[model samples]
Target: MTRRRPRPYDRELQNLRLHVGHERQGPVPVGWYFARFSRHLRRGEVVPVTYMAQEYALFRTRGGQLGMIDSQCCHMGADLGRCGRVSEERLVCGFHAWEFDRDGTCRKIPGAGRIPSRAAQRSVPVTELGGIIWFWHGSPAPEPLDELDFAEDRRRHLYLAGEVLVCHADLLPIGEHVTDASHWAYTHSPGRPMTSVQLRDEGRRFSFLIQPADADDTRIYHFRPYTLISMASPTTAVAVPQPGPRPDGKPPRMAFVAAVSPVRPGVTLATWSLVVRKFGPDWLLWPANRLWAAFLWRLVRRNHHADFDILRWMRPVAKDLWSVADGPTVRAYRRFYRRNLPPAMEEGAEERVSGMS
Candidate 1:
């Protein structure tokens, strides 16, 4: 009899890779939820929201109230997105006829008449603040939204807030854009041209400072550690202006501050609040400003697309594999992540790739 050839290990190796990665990389701790958009959700409109860095189902009622619930129905685990609705204050499951209230209470069970006292009632805790909605995924204790210090005059600035197209990238890479100054010169060049780029000799050092907002003003805040600090207004002048012919010679207008919060491991809620100074009769520059805003949006959108591709294809690299960009903000974000995020023991002690370790 002919000897049988040995089976190739490719498929088995792939499965092993996936399992090890998951065991090493546990779920990100539940953080803040994007509650503002939840408030804006319309009836029949189901949006994916994140808590504990995992996705959840977010829905609104015809009466303009919001509810966050498990994405799946309790019975048979049907996707609530497929068939779910608000009946009174409860969410009715399309399959198995189970009903869950806003608080995740089992109010009614079909064929059973009423829900039993022993049945488990699990619902996400939700809160509303500053026109945003928030939910807790960890301990039952409620975290205060007021803890994030919004600028005093944060509301005064002209603001445009919305989300970007969903991508498979992790939230950290996308959020890091805030501190990535180098991209402005290249990725954003198509829309907003950059005259020069600069980085510290050794590398960027992260420094965080809080600037108070004027009363009724809308200011952007960076959340690091346990505090929220105001982001500085964009400067109007460039160190070295573009080499080409000057168009009015004025510095490129600062569009607004864009912030990304991880709703889940791979999904992020990006909020861009456009801030513009109001000029009395100097409205002639408004058109230019608007054009610049559109350009900046395009630039950022392209950058995100690029990152999406990278994230989808590249395997995870250990922290030592890459060096932080030479910038203050970038340095600060790395420090923040190191300090706040759980340690490898909590995350599962998996050895990183040689260079990255």
Candidate 2:
């Protein structure tokens, strides 16, 4: 059998090997319904976006679809997000009254009385599901976004059981931890070795079963990594670029979902949906859920602290090492990124992001 090693020139992995701290690289994946922008943005609103190290304006049209373009208006360098309006499925720049469609095609120019030949805003494809907006970070695909649905019900996600964890770190590393089980002690550890950890990977999605090293250890953990595995448990987990929409429409509920979104060069946001179900007694569902919820929130917060302890300051890139729990899953994910997304817009690759190349 042949062993697989990462390409020698993969800069993202190389930087991780060299331990250069935190840097945002890699093309953001397609089909991810980003909830980070869902809070303040409503239909017919535009929000400035500086995600994946590129500048963009994410506007929700009245029809409830999302449209994206370079935040700067086509006429002058005014930030469209600051004073942008949506007229039907288009965005009207407050600066010049320029109107652009969902694909950034300029349809109305008040001054020119006709759309100029070069009056179009750069178009980025967008779709929405689960009460969240999603845009592709790669060349547009030929499928409609309604076909790209979220596996989890982002709309009805029980609020008491969930919280969003934001940090100034790129999302890839944090998202990768879901499959890297042995390292549980390094950060979210209970200060004891997990009895046994096993992983199963089925291409786009993978899961882990974490067990305490000893039954005699006899310690109960509020948030055992076990329940965070899939939809079967009272707990469920949905990671980004998670398994595509299910045919049965019964996507596994997630106990924790880390949806990654970029804010700027050195800042990133992850919506960590930590869902904790109530006790078996139906009567305890209300009053008891609160304290239990707080305990779960603390678990998530501590885990976040453990992650940010290094991620908050370290600029990390991928390093090709498959020596951890279910290493193949991590390798597969990295392969997916390198295969589907274009090179990260670094140094001077900004044109690629803005040009839709």
Candidate 3:
């Protein structure tokens, strides 16, 4: 008897199944994610980072280069983040003075002249942008961070909000919040109907515009996959509010980029980074820009409070319900998730992705 070949797995079908709120299970998608604020890690400093259920020793060497390696020292399983020191361009283990290069190779071992063949520690790819330190949670030779359209803007000016808040939430829901038009009225602005929503789908990304009934400002949202961004999980979202003209007759331009990273299964840390166009000289515009960005951060913080209250305890549940009021942008976002999913992850495993355990 001849056996028939099995059909290929359908990502679109899987996307639709999960879109309607079907319980999702599998390995989390691989991508860049915010690990810590760049300022917090000064030169020659080592910090501990726990994300995606793995611990890392994120360090800035004396030479001003960044590296992330397994937090544990192989000598005796000592926590590297707690006992390691950055020496010039390498991490020196305090336990036995075992030195490791950025590539996870053990170069020196104190007292003993010979190093073990398996004394090397695992290292993760890391980059710095927009005042955030990010690490890749997938395969080696990660994509370049400069590929992001806003890369220059983030690097040139201050982009981070002063405070980063941690919440018990899912990555997808938090990233898709900007595209969720229906909930704005009830969740963010009461009595202001967010009924006038328009969308422009660009396959990999989709932009939407919204004008609330009680507000004069027009809000625009850009949602896309976070494959190369400095701060995003599987998806990245940006929201811009176009308010009326200022006293100078020129409308102020600013955007809030939502950056979220999954710390574990259901817990995520989210923050808003402000991006503004420079108006005047650097000496004057720099301070003004920071103040303006800080003001906007407060607004974002207030708005997200409502979201945190609801998302903190919510689980990924599928409802056999559909409504046009949810808008096309939401549907497009669901499709985006379906197409961008990674292979099923191992269940209850220490090493969920490559370079992480």
Best by TM-score: 3
Q: Which parts of model 3 have CA positions greater than 4 angstroms off?
A: 1-26, 145-148, 151-156, 195-233, 241-253, 284-287, 318-320, 344-357
On residues 1-357, what C-alpha lDDT tens digit does candidate 3 reach at each position? Answer: 111221121122122232221333335556677776676777888876656666678888887789999988888988787778888899988788899998778999877878889999999988877567778876535765532445455434556544455555667666666666678778975445564344444433445555554444333343211111112344555555544211222322555666677665556666656566555657767778777767777866777778766765555454424576666665565555544454343333223222110
> What's the ranking of the predictions by lDDT, best on top?
3, 2, 1
Please give the TM-score that candidate 1 achieves against the real structure: 0.55
Number of backbone collisions per candidate, in order?
A: 20, 13, 2
How many angstroms is residue 273 displaced in model 1 relative to the true structure, after the best TM-score fit?
4.9
The whole-model C-alpha lDDT of candidate 3 against the native structure comes to 0.61
Q: Against the hidden reference, what TM-scores do the models get? A: 0.55, 0.63, 0.73
Candidate 1 to native Cα RMSD, angstroms: 13.2
Error in Å for residue 107 of model 2: 2.3
| Model 2 lDDT tens row, 118-175 | 8777866665444345565554453443221333343334333233344555555644
**Model 1, poorest ten-residue lDDT window?**
232-241
Q: Between candidates 1 and 2, name the one with more favorable lDDT.
A: 2
Highest lDDT, which number? 3
